[model samples]
Target: MNLRTNFVLGALLLTSGVWSQTGLVPKQFLSLPLGQIGPSGWLSDQLAVQTNGLAGHEHEFYHYVSQTDWVGGNSFYSTLEEAGSYWFNAMVPNGVLANSSVLNQKTSAFLDYVLSHQDSTGWLGPEVNTTKPRYLWGRYPFMFGAIQMVEAHPELTDQVVNALHKFVALANTMLHNGQGQEDWTRVRWPDFIMVLQWLYDFHPNGKEDLLLDTMKQLKFTGAPWEDVFSTELFPKGATDNMRNPTGFVLTWHGVNMAEGLKALPATYRFTHNQSGGLSRIIGILPLMSLFALDLDRASEGWDLLFQYHGRPSGIFAADEYLAGLEAVRGTELCLVVETIGSYLYQVIGDPKYLDRVERIAYNALPATLTGDFWSRQYLQQQNQIAAQNMNPHSRNPFPNDGPYSNVFGLEPNYPCCTVNHPQGWPKFITNSFLTTPDQKSLVQAYLGPFSTRTTLANNNQVSVSVDTLYPFSDTLTTTITAAQAFTYHVRIPSWVSGGTISINGGAAQALSPNNGLQAVSAKAGTTKFVLNLPAKITTGTFQSRPHGSIAVQRGPLHYAFDIPRNSTVLARNAQESRAVDLQFEATAAWQYAIDPSTLKFINSPPQSGALPSPIFDSNLPPLSIEVTACPINWNIAGSTFAASPPQNPACVGAQKTIKLTPYGSTKLRIGEFPVFKST
Candidate 1:
């Protein structure tokens, strides 16, 4: 019944196989090709900064607990701080500790602290000194830190190894004594699993009697798996969401649960023939209702995310009310990052998932980061300022709508996000490139730079390299090098225009129109992917406006450019209208140069100072211009900023400047463009 202890034991059981590879990975788990687009830690950097700020934070944990009775009285702050600090350090290149010496010293010091405080029961947790020292499970992370230190710095001393074994023995003891809890299910299961599996994988034939009982309780069978498709709430006292605003039922993403189910096959294998544990857990729910298992579930979630709950930047929120009520209040940065993380796991093979992944990565994900990638807003809305400042975690006020505003840090409204959010960025960067059991690889997402060696299904080792300037350039090229033959599937993005596939300097085959990947069959030589995407644009109608034409999609993003009083285009709650005629002015004007650096916003004037004004800082980036020749001239009446520019500005003597840019490029500009046709 002890969940934490059970998880430890189950991990030991799963790690029955110990294997190492300095070369190619076997053809089992798909391996992503080495590519730059998937390597950048743009979002990951933001999360790490926040994590370091909070964990050893002066008020959050370290400093506060250090001053309280909890540090030396009844709790194990010393070890928790050590474990957290070590894991946090393992992430960064130099980390908190400058070099191997510092890392080893810190690790050794932590081990010494833990060894000095170990209770006779072999259990180590929060209540290290109490009679019921076994009651706490929070200290389990220290054991995880031990394994991490070993992994990050392989030069573990004999003393370090001996110290680690003691912690493991203590963990084993806790399980034997039944000190683990039953209600604790892993929301961050993958993180713990990585360490647990590592221990068993490295020390095969180490312990069986110690892990058997714990594995049984740790399996998904006993964990509560709810119906994620429906809006069904968990029983009042049974779960966290019952408290309202805190639970996964309403607030947690269904996609995350779906992704965990999809990854069950590998974990099942890790457990060594002990199967059905995953099914037993999944069997509790309607299989058809599982979003990852059924397409309908995906459609429904997407319907809400795209059609109803979508924001201008492409992220969706799980907030109480539908988004667009107040874009800032609805979308949480954690939810945005986690949603993508889950979706990638569930549908990595599908092109649609890749499309959504790219959209969210380029749009929603970047919206939160400051221009320099330093500070981040927990939530962001269109037509709102996006700097790091305190804002209400709950609803907003007045015209913005929702709860109180200007709140900061990890508020009670939802603090789990504070911890859970960090996992997203790191995982996102790592998983972007996956290697199929066969060494052949594909580019699932694009960031910047990274590389890994992988094994293919045929057991051939291929060094797959991906190179591209994406989000900026339309073409992405992957070069595969191997001693043998291997087939690689390259995901052709849904947004790609005139995307052609050429392998090893041969005539390219035009893959199935949009969104279909072009598979490349080649040997050890060298294959190149050359894609020529001409400038293109698509138009959609504003459902609410009469004779209004709105631009729905351009390249990979949907854009809206709203200029002042004629602001029907990017106004509050603006949507696609059927009555409007949307025309793409495919002329020279449609290709204006844009300044990428000028994408920030000007602050809104304070209420007491003056009236609400629709103005932006002149210092912001200049809009990317496109000259679209329109048939009609609405500016004959002297309106300088017409919805659409006239064929000839001289007729109206209103030579107005038309500033148009990609919707994804601007966080400050009005997105919806007004539509004007005869009538």
Candidate 2:
């Protein structure tokens, strides 16, 4: 393409919400670096723990070199490497001085390893003999980290850019040879396209047309995801397979769908004239819903997800496939992190999306992580009763997951979750606050104790500091130190009905939320706003299980019956290297089912000091619930509780008051419980 043709094409893209300068959809809110918004309380503790644990640094999957523990060929390591990179990249910049941030050296050697070992062919990972065609998927995050480090580590630009060029050249050559035929790769080609798109912005010279043409070939020809997503014809409706077709399996895989969700919105950036093929894929979302019609498939896929497999933790159950909404089925750690990134990074600038992000981040995300962070679960259950292997009973909870799938250990069934899990908290911190798409205002999506520093209208430095333990309390106090006035978009969850925002603690004003956000205009100089987000206990029932098996939710936290457990350490938390193996079998009775009518929500006053640093410290959580219930002799099936509370289970004991703890806080508890009555 000539320069004249390029100019004409660029003009068309600019008019369609993409900036011609970047050749991509404009980021509505630019995510600041890690240190700008350092995490405190549970969120900070998670990252800090990951940094010290196997997920953060210790695991052999990340620093694997010898054959004993290679990262399962290059197919998986590249993705794991990408996740670990985010940890080190964000941690080093988290301090006032970039050189001395938390956990900096842990990642420095890995960066050095990557830069020192790049082959002339552009392959940057350990060379192994295997055919893992999803090779390109691993490169997605490498480029993400590389591009991020472009400014922070300018010395790596030429090397990173050249390596991408070589890799694309290799892909283009293989495509001409008809070699890009990985079943999973065809669906996940978006990952490869994403990195190419980023490179198009950074590397723009003679090969601009070659880059697009190369992407055209790399789109993985024969995969008709458009036809798959064009309508809701695939199997949905949770368990019974509502729309069953021949082999409607791969797309149902949670992690695949989570990564593929970004396919269309991203593909739309390139083809300005949605004329069929990949561009026509945008129309696929309308049938999912209007909100999704404009948004990406993330919303559509998430709709189908929650509709059937939804859990109170704001995530769905997919052990390997579309595991239904049964509380026994556990969500993969891979999907959890993927879903969070899709909401915050891929689909930007929507507070409604944060509702899901906050729930999973606050509950499910950490529930899987050990209190010490030395180990994590390969899969975590919604109503997890025990964490032990329990000798693999007559029933099978995970078809592919091993017996100890839910146990908190080094790498229970698979090691992918270990490497992939670290990305969640670090990425959340980097994007904790979002600058509006117009770049005029900033949005506080996640509620926690974090500060925001961004330039306002007149290039004035503005800082807003939040001092409150959120997801633990409803009250939030924010102090703004600004050189000039700016508009601050405060997000209140869609579940919140009524709340008040008083400027500097004077004259409380009732807030009417629109799309889960309240835009507050902050004045110049020092300004403060105390916004109270109302938290309530919401009751929901199991769709697949027996009727009235309820799950309780308050604010973002899910409530579970605090069943006491006698823990058996399968592997000790030898922090530096070995993963923690904690299996907590019930120490106290767990068969109590709360009477919905008698349940009461109670919260403790905010701690004058900092939130506990350990993961899921349940001794005295920020909130608790009081409820009166009778003991139902619930039966156990396989390694998990019976999928459904027994039908007309005989209530054997007197009704009593039992305290409920946060779902995320419990290691041996039930999120979905059978109400004990005459049944």
Candidate 3:
């Protein structure tokens, strides 16, 4: 049979029962299993660099990763176990996507050890005994890591599911008995609930009651995110205390708030009863009702949170806490990765979530890590000038963070970010594409250079190869090969004004975006199309500095003044010459205000056929913009952090054209710039 006939037959066979096995609300799109999607082109090169950098080497030297409870070593603190879990969770996808045997072997060994060493009581991880005050927080990431592994390698599914079943039984009992309920686990229960939902959907084995009961226990004991977002519990602005009336610290935390954003949507899928009877009415009438987890309310709360606390880098300020919208305030690396993950969860609910994910991934994520990915900053400032340690006596801008908060190092300020940072890029690559609810279509949820091969609902295998220098170039070339006909959906970002698509070397046609997605139909054989998303320079004023200062964006990338810097090594690894800790001091003046009218975007084609090894390096960005700027008296706060740009500041020197590169490329950058007053 031809492709069209096979697709039609497959559609006839697809039933509601086949799609709705979990008895939950239907998602618009479903994530392709791990190993189905792989990175290519610049993205592939980037992951390779990451594998050869700190992420690959940390296991050999970093004590937290090297000597952790997960690997039969002794580490007392729960944070240590949690750190190890983060590394494992990130490496699973990185290894699978990059096809790196080294990473794959290390990840496999860790998984084997953890699965083989499960306690008799069904508890997973090192905290086995109840007398030690068990914390369920660390298990969250480990379970996710295991789930990814099972997705990549299906042979491990039976073992993983059986182990999860045992653990869920024990966890259900513990939660009922008021055990393993800590602050971190309480707010982060959404992650745990997600795992249960995944198990119920994919492999229930007639244990639906147990999964639902466990989910209920978790929701009851967990942070009331639905109530928090709907009521006054949601902070209107940056407040010192984000504790609700009951004294639960949920929204105050940067990472917790980011993770908690998905609680409502996730709960709605399982708990939301669409039958609409007296039970539904009763559930909705009560204040802060358990069944009132509306997706709309969740979206509104997300927007409101970013409105006040958000920064130009597409993340909210959280120097350990919810810092306000001032450009000087820094966002923690943990928050950045969690924010991206939270948005990815909501992409099925709203395609616009992909926009936020791309912005954070391309800008905030790379800017915080070094070009080699060997070191990273605990907190990344929007208008950062230097990465040196601040004087202890000086008034620190990040009151909740430490003096080394912004410095690039192995474990500056904290080790949480060090381990957690690996997840940002790897997850982004894996979650780039999604399948439609009916499985007749594949959606390019996030734009990037990646390829996917997966079986559709019709049981017909389809392969898509996407080649592009996106967020850097306007054109994307996609080649699809399928055994059956399928619809291909590409997300046309809101930033594109003149988008066009040409299929099979035909005439180019205007690309109309519907809810930020454009669809095209394909046959059984190979089909090729080129999508041109021409981006223009877009500028917007900062919320903290609305009048005289602004941030620049083109497509998904944020542009910043690339301040020249001089590096100083603070600490070096004993086994290698690489610096474990380093400081970047600005060698040239960064106090510049730009003339927006004179901004000119420039693209330099690579002289070679391939892109740079580290695409995020200072001198490696293929695109930049030249703008007329002049030196201004931008002051520094606490002798370290850059203060908010001066309102209507006068230029201090002669105006000169300066280059502004992608925010991710610059270590010392001025992202939010003051507008120069020509007078």
Candidate 4:
């Protein structure tokens, strides 16, 4: 039979449920549609600040975003397509979550232009000449943004599906013909597969085989992620130490590793064979077994990766490539967001993944961006005490990245992070709450102030609102209104020593959590649930740091010593005051070692009736800890970077009590400190 005839027959079988029973493992929780859940409380305030800052204004001042080919401009950069795609990807979620009409309108217009300009050959985005290979990597982000836009505006669904169908057909042919299967596109094929899977699951339009075939072609031509994870080929240390690392550069790239984490799991969903019923059953056994083994190996690989190179910020060192565990080495902003995306789609449904998500979001994500969101860094260090451009004479910790990588500015070192960082918070907000496959139960997968509306089984409509300052405060209150009774599940973070939940002012019940989730039965009508998670101050050591050095944490938020700073304007746009790049230098001493035992949690009343605007502002953290510290003669590694903490450093000055704020709130801060033991 011809290919078209075979696909038609397969569609018939699928519709008849003959091929519906599959080998894929079901996810414990399914993500809700975009716009169904949104930011509230302090989280909402943060998104508003983003809207008023770089994310909302990039198109106006940033030439990469403003004059890109996607919007009919004549910018002639080879990677302009990727750059424009990144901006649109971030802006869609940010606009929808922030509810900014202006941003939404801009995103809408960009989508309209791209869709309307799709090539006649079923290609999406700008068309390169036939002689030049059309790269597929850029279109992945555009499709991601387009999906979210369609979710938010259902009226555009038909147009989006039509465009996607055409593009997928073209992509399948391209993969077969080796048109755009470059290193990046090959390594990051899971992103494209995910878009294909979305279409297969939601809007197949009776072309399920075509979608599945496209996925298979892409996977066959893609990087060997499963093999990379399953074998010893996975880098156990920094990639630079490996022999001839250039050949394996793409495999060891930090952002690719983050995005590749889910590759095997995603591939398993479509590896099912559908030739004949008995043959399919026989084929499934080996595939399932291989997938199980692959999953375990992938998990172990990740553990080893983190064990050797992980940082306290819930991200591993990767200043473009995989750096080791040194506190001074920088982690890329792209790694932070992509790691969050990987965890969200990991399919294992492990609560620890959610915990990691919160850690990266609350600390590392914000630390890279300015409080006002006007500028950001390509790389951030856990022990960052300054945001100045690196001196040429300095021994660079980030060998793979540029000297200006850690400075806060517009396109400090690369334009990729500038366009890519916007997806961090918006994705967090939307994926905060999830529903079961049955749609009967709601799972509060990640903690934050957000509200959601979902329809449960039996046509039960439910709306849930969470109110509290989480990660900063100990208490969270959830109000649920449902048309019918359903169970509400909340994830109890592993960091909490103990927690209690109360129902509508009734006596509190000690939370008995299973798999890091606490479940409560709610009635058909309105129900109120209050949870108190008392977090204790804790300290831990990093492998690459001095033996006596330690990092502090309370709940999900990391604590850092906020360094006083003087800001210098490195560059600025003449047309806009907020559009400026800045360099920061520590004004006061930063070489202080603290006694961990002296740490005491402190909570201050909100300055006003509500959380402060630009919630991550250096002076506005509502929670802090007081610790006894003493000045020490900590050395500098190079001309600029702080060296490893001295082992049991001697106090050089009289000890004094100092306050440490949340890591996300500080622009220049010390997250890990040396120990100053009293004689």
Candidate 5:
């Protein structure tokens, strides 16, 4: 019954040969081609920056050039960092084909470097780290790329599966000698499990349970993240202290926690309750629910993390550890991307999971860098006032982080984020809308301007095109092109009130959302749905800063005070490189308190377009609100916003009209504001 030391594979799978990939990947939800679900509005503009800018030239950097480094050249980063970025690099072309022309060329070059450099034994990344000092965790990203590409180009499935099979054999051989056991392997077992499961379905002669058994055995003894997620309260005793511990039972790395969040859920799918050692022991831990499976507790865990370590941007502060809820702690880019992926997995099972996805999508996902994707931060703090290299980790905040953690450059503290940030937007678009597991209903996950073409029952084709400025405006219009009538499901955010839906500009029907989904029937041919997704401002009591400060949220967006700042370009040499880094420094004071009672908001939509350009910054968020507030005597903490507001501080500054922008739009702003009792 020991899930830790031994695992028994299920006999339910077809024992004869490799089971069909179709079995694991239900045809229920079909993602349209890369070109079909094209990016529009501000999202498309961001991709344009990606295609012509950093996405085009990031590999040019020596650290990311896998061909040279994997062969003989020296690399500044571990092979895992470079290999993990393959999923992002492969997606550049998929997202950029609509706005730019260089996507295909860039993707071809990237694949050539990756596909052409594999060793005879099926190893692709740096050969040095594949099987030493425990095991290197570089193969999973290639596995991710393989899974994504196999469907687009089925001809490559054989090659992809064969290479991974050889690599897994190599890993099995190495770990069998009691040589491969480390925190990295233990914390990352789920990634390898993903590859093995994919091969089990796709490979012509998939190994069925043997491959999974080998992967399970390769993991370190009795480690990695099972008991902590047993309930809505983690640690089982969380009723006493509900804060989610930053470090796992095995390790404290935030990225591990983020990437492995879905491990238990994925396991439940592959090993449903069976009378086996693995299931017998695993079943002891309570981590399963309906469609989301273990993720219900996972979401609860995340909610607690937000309470203790989270920033207003929908990410937890963890430079290298679970940095507390201070505004100064730096949030790593890898954590941001991996957390998005984790939440996205939840959405695939059901659209209701988008409650978490929208928060990250509207706030943390887009606020990391400049309008152009040329340069980015290795770590971004919620209250950062400057972007440069320095070692403040030894101070009040995160300690494990490197000196250049918050710098905005091609390869700041590390090259990991530089190479890994591309998957954030493209994947969000591709997964925006998906059909239900039964394929009878279409569910909207992420909101924004996009299009989709999906197949319903009886081979009916439905094409949907939506035009709206979501996350900014509360209204959306959806147009459906179909020949047959079917049920269409839309997820209305929980914050929405007084919601109404109209068909073809007809009478607005009063409706109530049930479990976040509103199911309505559409007739044949053209059908249009106009929705009024109303939002209201609400406040919560938190003692973090300013004693009694409140976070202002509307719809899916949080508004923050835009801190005035100045920027200067960072040059590689005396001459400027194609990629120039812009570093910002605070120009105006950021310490201010708002009048909670006098809170007033105004809507300012774009005059013409669905949204405004420079959507994330440059002071153009398409929509903004004016609030009446006064400045307080707050202090800055080590070049960032201080931890807490002064106790019972006097409001000496004059009352002023403060214009607040969306949390994603202000690179330097305070989303969590202190309230002044007197104005």
Candidate 6:
């Protein structure tokens, strides 16, 4: 425990590819604090309570599939299998307290069904007398199942482990047998790679042949998924090699690749195989994809749904696959859940990964959910005014779009999305803490309460206990208990500039500003960290008449100056030099008053040349002659409040007063105002 440096080259860290040699497996997953958690107690409760509904559906769906179709009908089972795996993954930790037996039974039954469907040819899937012959979509069920089984039940039967290996053999053979005619396109290779990582974990023997070779032969450039494999989307036959791949870069590639990249190196270390290097190269594709998209676009490939009338509980939407950001259209549930998974892989090794993840989690995730997590829409528009029907596959409501409806249920727009969304909640909570290979415990996110225990490379035990009302408050107290004195690294949130760190209640000097500060020493028994969050504001853009300007921000929240509704804000000459000047009367916060009636906001700030130059010299009580435009209201997503300036600013000299609040607090108010400033 009395070791100095924890950094080692090529050692396995947490989930991120950076390796650190740890004596014991990591106890916590890395989590990124995206933002605030909306009041979605419903979704949380459902995941906590009614997860069985989805599990049962997966069981029934899988049960109905005949053995003959296991090979051909693999996609159907693969879909159902993923649903079951995610349900089990999300519910298992919590289910241990409630109905552990039922949870295990359902999960075991599903696995049993998958194993039963394994073909004699080592191929795993329902080769039912369907139109298609034996395919590889179903191969992942065994691969992923093997992984979940090994992780969840390390003492799993050798037969079960061997069966999974056989399934991979079948996948490899099936892929090779059909090589003469055409290459497999629709098959998801990443999923295969992920499962292979798991399969190789238990089966360290060199007996696994085709699985390794097939993984090596797989080469996907340009599009994300192999286009030809998806017969469902293109029933006749795939003419082009590209299929519709939907997801933000971080969500699809980052997490998926992180796991593989990290696992490959670890697997290589264990098996002494060079194949791990290949996986690392494959993992770089997503990073490459990020570069492929030009940097200029704000929210580029990541599509946002912007339906006007019908909206979902969440913020962004992408139901119909990468539907560009239209305020009326909606976002996809798949994107939300997948993004969480991706962030988990990114933040473990690097602290900056926390920034992007937190943005998506806090802003994008919570924006869509209703107070409780109960009903979720597949998509939500940014400019959405109210909640409407969310029925799946409904006609887009836009003039060119179809009908809008609430696709709320186990299966909304698509059954797969419904199955995938549940993983986000449980996995997100679990990833709040992570451990490095050096056995250093890192607290990447702040979510409620949790405990983690990890062993360092020296076989020393390290335990971390985090206590705080983080995100809601600025202070975090972390208690580290170690068997021996060891140095641990902790990440500093980007939002925090600098603060005092107290070890065990004693004030320690400020920490460095590197990606992560140097290791903090654990005294004889315990080491504590007390971080004070710095007061700060963030920057954002707002719309004025001619062009938009930047707005100063504090924390995650943005601020705005309250401009009375129905006041017209003009730029005058379309340039800042000739812009409309807004009259600002600072009471508590800045307030702008144009005309009390037909309230509208002026675009330019109250400065010289903002308003028509003549109005400034007039003796008209500074408010009477201000330009008037349509009224605008500032409110949260829903709570409406009047934007009218306080008690007639025109009569201010008549012993009256005007009230105001920060622009961030006011939901609806004029961000830009026009006032004539004397030059």
Which candidate wins on lDDT? 3
Kindly indicate the candidate among 1 and 2 with the higher lDDT.
2
Per-residue lDDT over 396-490 for candidate 4, one digit per residue giving the tens place of the 0 to 100 score = 88888778888898888888888888889888887888887777899998887999987888999999999988877888999999999999999
Among the numbered candidates, top TM-score falls to: 3
Clashes of 1: 51
Q: Which residue window of length 10 is worst by lDDT in model 4?
A: 285-294
Give the C-alpha lDDT of model 5.
0.61
lDDT over C-alpha atoms for residue 207 of model 2:
71
lDDT, candidate 2, 1-679, per-residue tens: 2223333443454456542333455555555543456665555555666665664444333343211232333432443334444343333443222233333544445455565666666555544233444244445555565665654566767876877787788777765566644556666667677777767866755577667756655542423343345445544545334443423346667777666666655555554323343334555432222112234553454465576677788788888776876778778988888777433343445565677778888888777876677778888887777887757645767775678788888767876676566667766666678776556777787788777776755686889888777877787899888777788887787667477899876998998666666888788889899988885677744223335577777778888876777877776544333555778777778877767777788877645656666637565576888888778777677755555665555568877788888777777777777775432
For all predicted structures, in order, the TM-scores are 0.57, 0.84, 0.92, 0.91, 0.84, 0.58
lDDT of 5 by residue, 573-619 (tens): 22227666667777987777777666666777777865555578757
Query: For residues 1-679, what per-residue lDDT tens digits would candidate 6 score against the true structure?
Result: 0001111111122224432232212212422221111112222333443344333233334332212243443433544434444444444433432335665665565566667766665655444333345545434434544454455565665756777677666666654454311222322445565556445534645754455555433322112221111112211211122343322132222223222222222222222322223333555433322211111111211211112111112223334433332333445555565555433233134443444454444334543332224334454343333333323343343322232222333333444444455555555554555555333444434333344565655667767766643333456677788787766665566666666677777766676746654467776478887766654543222111111222223333222333322212222222112212111112222233322232222223234412222111112111211222222222232121122222212222222223222221231233333221111
Residue 315 alpha-carbon offset, candidate 4, angstroms? 1.7
Give the candidates in order of lDDT, highest first. 3, 4, 2, 5, 1, 6
Query: What shift in Å separates residue 243 of candidate 3 from its native position after superposition?
Result: 5.7
List the RMSD of every prediction in angstroms.
13.0, 6.0, 7.7, 5.3, 5.2, 16.1
Per-residue CA lDDT of model 1 for 1-679, tens digit only, reads 2344434534453454321111111223342321222242223333334334432232223321222333353332443533343333223222222223433454455455555666565544445565543432344445544544554455653444555455555654544555453323333333333334444445424553433333333333223222332233222111222343323332244234333332332233233322233434655433211112233343444433444345545555434333332323335555565556433333323455556666666565544433333223354444332122223452232222223111123321333333333334444555566555323454334333334355556566666555543444454566676667666655556556676666566786666642344556657766555554433454432112112323345455544442221111111111212112111111122211122222232223233432111111122222244433222233211111123222222222222345454454443333433333211
Where does candidate 6 stray beyond 4 Å? 1-101, 128-134, 138-146, 157-160, 178-187, 207-211, 220-317, 324-329, 342-348, 390-402, 405-410, 438-448, 541-630, 633-679
Worst 10 residues of 6 by lDDT: 1-10
Q: What lDDT does each candidate get?
A: 0.39, 0.63, 0.79, 0.78, 0.61, 0.38
Our model 6 lands, by Cα RMSD against the true structure, at: 16.1
Superior by TM-score: candidate 2 or candidate 5: 5
